[model samples]
Target: MKSVEEADYVIVGGGSAGGVLAGRLSQDPACRVALIEAGGSDRTRLCTVPGMVSIIHTTPKVKKRFDWGFYTAPQPHGAGRRIPYVRGRVVGGSSAINGMVYVRGHRQNYDDWEAEGCTGWGAADATRCYKQLEDWEGGEDAYRGAGGPIAVTRSRDLVPATQALVEAIAETCGVPVVDDYNGADQEGVGACQMNARGGRRYSSSEAFVQPALARPNFHLISGAAAARVVIEGGRAVGVELIDGDRRRIVRAAREVILCAGVIGSAHLLMLSGVGPAAHLRDHGIAAIADLPVGQNLHDHLFVPMTFLAPTARHRGTALHFLGGMVKEAMHKGDTWFSRTVFDALGFVRSSQAERGVPDIQLHCLPWSYPSPNQDRPVRPVVDKRPALTVMPTLIYPKSRGEVTLTSADPTAAPHIDPHFLEEEADRRLLIEGMKLVREIMASPRLGDIVQGELHPGPAFTSDAELAAELPNRIHTVYHPVGTCRMGVDDRAVVDPQLRVRGVDGLRVADASIMPRVIGGNTNAPSMMIGERCAELIAAAH
Candidate 1:
C-alpha cells in the first residue's frame, strides 16, 4: 500500500461520461471530485484534428498510442476471426480518437428505455439532458440546444464525392433530406454533425474536463489503472489503483461512479466481486453480489462495400491523400482537417413496409482501402485508384454477447465475445442495407462516377450470397453498449438511476448502462448519459 487519497465523489475512467460528471459535480464548492484514468494525457495535436483520426486509430497501420488495443475472442459467427476492439485509453477516451460524428440517435431509442422499466429515462428526459450538454451551431430550436459545453455543427464543407452521394441517397433511396437528424425525425439523409469548434475536434476532455482543471476541489489522476473497487459491508468505499510501479487506494466519502465505458465498467465490476456468483467462483474470486454484470452485450456491425468512383478527390494511396491533406492544412490550417472523411450520413428502414423507424444506418466515405477486411495490426493499404465506400451498419442488432474474466489477474484483458452476426435477423438486415446501398450507388449522380463495384462486386447480388459472406466482411462500428445494463429487472446490473445493484454508494455511468443500444453513433449519447448521471447525483446529494 503506497498511499491513500480522498474525495467526495470518486469517478473511475476519465472518458466521456466521467469527464462530464467530474466537471458537473465539482461545480459545488463543498464537493471534492476525483477522476482516475487508466491512460495519460491527450494533449497531442493528433487528437484535435478530425482528419488525423485514422492516423491515430480505426486503421491498423497506426500504432496504438491512445488505444487500449484489445482484441475480441474468436467469434464463430465472424469467420472465427479475432477482431480488433479499439477503445480510447486517453483522458477523453474514445471521443479523443473517434470519427468525431455527433449523433444523439433516434429519440425513440430512449423512449424504448423508459418503456422497458427504465423510469425517468424517457425521450423527454434524454432531450432535457441533450439540451443541457450541446452548443449547437445551428442555433436553438425545439430540440437543438445552444450555448453549452459541447460544440456541435453539421458538416458544411462537404467534398464533391460526399455531396454527390448525399443527393443520390435522396434520389434513389426515397429518404428525405432532413436539416436536423437529431430533431423530430432521424430517418433521413443529413450532413454529418461533429463535435468540433473553430476547426478543431472538441472532445469531452476539452468540453468538460479541461474547463474544470482549475477548480481547487477537483483532482484528476491520470496513468493509473483501477485494480478493483474497494467494497466493505456491501458498500463501495473506494477503489484500488495500479499507478505504474506502485499501488494506491482512492477513498470515496460520498460515492464511486464507474464511467469506464462498456467493456471497462463491466470488467471492473466483475473484478471487484460484483458479478455472477458462479463465474466469480470459477475464477477463484469471492462474489459480493450475483447480479449479471457483463450480459446483454451488443454493438453495431457494418459491412463496407467499395465502388470505383474515379472523380473522388481523396482517391489514390494513403501517402498521396496524406500529402494532399498536409499541404491543404499548411495553407488552410484546421479547416480541411476538421472535417472527417465520413461526412455523409443517412438512416433508413431495411424495408419500407417494416416500420417508420430506421433499422440500418449508412455512412459514406470518399475514400477506399485495398481490402475491406479491417482486422487489427494488419494494415490494408489504401489503393491508388479512385473509389468511394459506403458502410451499411446494423443499428439494432439482435445478437447478444458477454464479457468474462480470462483470469483473476486484474491487469489482464477480459474475454470479449460480441457474437457478431449470430442472429438471423441481424444478418438479414445487413443484407437489406447492402441492397439499398447498391440502389443508391446506381442513381444518376453517383452512377456516372461509379465505374464498378470493388469489394463483393456485382456478382454477389442475391440475399443468400451477401449473407454467406457477411462474417468475412462485417466489422464493428465501435458503438458497444448494454454490458452492465440498467433496468428494474432482476438480471440488470444497475437500476434506472444507474446505481449498481446489491451495492450502495456506487454507480455505473457510461454506454454500459444503456438497456439497449441506440440507432446511431454513440459518442453523443454517451456524453448525454454523463450529463444525466451528474443530474442524478446532484439531485440525490
Candidate 2:
C-alpha cells in the first residue's frame, strides 16, 4: 500500500547486484532505494546452511522453491539433448543455490576486459573491489580481501583421499601445489575457497543487504516482478511491476538498475524493447533501442569422468561418515557440504600455445554417480558409497549461444541456447584436458588408492574413445555470462560504467554485463561487480 513514487532509485531484481546496490546506495540518509525481487525471501533453512549447496540445486522440494529451473533448447553437439538450466529465483539469486566456491577467476580475465573496451575493469580495479567485499579466512594480502562482509574460508575439511589426489596431481603431473589460486600463482592443485563461515552459507543478500535493511531509506519488495521500463521522453522514468494481483508503477527519480542476472536481465531488456530490433518486432513489442542484449551467450562446459573410490581398507573415514555427522549436528543442518566431496581443484594448460595461461580447470571430487534426470536437482550421490570423479572444464569456450522470448508474458521462461561444444576447438581442448586427468589417475601412487575406472573404463584408452564419451557426460558449469556484454563497441549493451547505451537513467549491474565470462566460478565476480558498480553510481551522484 505504500507509494513507490517516494523513491529516488528503483532497482529491479534484488539478486547479487541489486542487493549490494540497495545496501550501498541507502547509506546516504537523503537517498531512498527500492529493491524489487520476483521470488520470495532468501531467508530459508536450505539457503543458510553451507552443506545445502548441492541440496539447494538438486533436491526436488528445495530446488523448485528457489530455482528458476529452465532448460536449454537442445544442444546440437550434445546428441541433440536438452540441457537443464538452473537460475536462482530467490532474493540472493544464483548465489543462494550455487556451489559456494569462492574463486575470483584469473587476474588476466579482468585485464582482458580492459583490452576489450571495458575502461576501468582491468585486473587492478577488479582486485580493489574484490578486496573490499570479502572477509577471507586467510589473512589479508595484496590480493585477498579482509574485514569484509562475505566470509571466505579455504577448504580445511577435505577427505584424506582428496588430499592424496591433490598431492598426486602435483608430484606426478607437472602442476605445482599452490597455496592460493587467487594469489600470484594461478596454475596448480589447491583447496577451494568457499563463501562460507563456521559451516554456513553467506549469500550476497546476507553480506550486503541485511545490514542495510535496518536503515529507514531501504525498501524491499519480495514478490514484485518487473515487467518493463516506463520510458517517456526518451528516458527511463520508472518500472512497470506486476505485484501479485495489482500492477504497480514505481517511479525512479534518479536511476533504474536491472540486476536480474544473465538470463533474467537480458529477458527483461528484450521485454522492455531494447534488444535486437528484428527480434523485438517478432515479439510484437515496440523497439526502444537496437542493441545486442542476448546474442553472445557463453558458459563454462565440463565433462565428468567417474572412477571407483579408494578400496574399503583404503577408505579411512568410513566414506566420510564421522566428519559428516559431527559437522551436521554442530551446524544444525546436514554438513555434507563441509565434508563436501569436491575438495581438490587444479588449473592447467591444455596446450602450450596459450603460454602462461591455464585454459582448463580440473575439479576432483571424492564421490561419483550419474547425473539426476532432467527433472531433478540434487547432484547424484550414491548413499554410503565412496567414489572419485575428475571433471575437465573448458574454461574459455569459443562457442556462443543465445536467449530470446517465446511470448510477451513476463512470467514465461526465456528460450536459452547455450550451444554447448559447438566449436571443434573447444572439443579438442577438453579432450586433451580429460587426458590430463587420465594421466593423473594413471600415476602409480594414484593406482594404489582407487579400485578401477568407472566411466570410459580402463579399456577405453584411446583419445577417440574418451572423445566419444564427452557427448554423454558434458554439462554446464552454471557460469553463463556475456548476454548483455559491457564495452564501447557497437554491439555492446552497456558501457564500461554499466549504463545502458542510448538510454538515460538506466544501467545494468549483474552477470549479464560481463564482456567475457570469467575463467572460474561467477559468484565472486558478480559480487565484485555489485561492489564496484555501487561506487560508480555513487561517484556520478
TM per prediction? 0.96, 0.94
Would you give me the overall lDDT of model 1?
A: 0.85
Evaluate model 2: give its TM-score. 0.94
Best by TM-score: 1
Worst 10 residues of 1 by lDDT: 369-378
* Model 1, residue pairs in steric clash: none
lDDT of each: 0.85, 0.80
Q: On residues 261-295, what C-alpha lDDT tens digit does candidate 1 reach at each position?
A: 99999999999999999999999989999988899
Candidate with maximal lDDT: 1
By TM-score, how accurate is candidate 1? Answer: 0.96
lDDT of 2 by residue, 66-169 (tens): 88879899777886778888888888888876788788899999999999878889999999998888888787999988898888877775666777788878
The candidate 2 region of ten consecutive residues with least summed lDDT is 311-320
Global Cα lDDT for candidate 2: 0.80
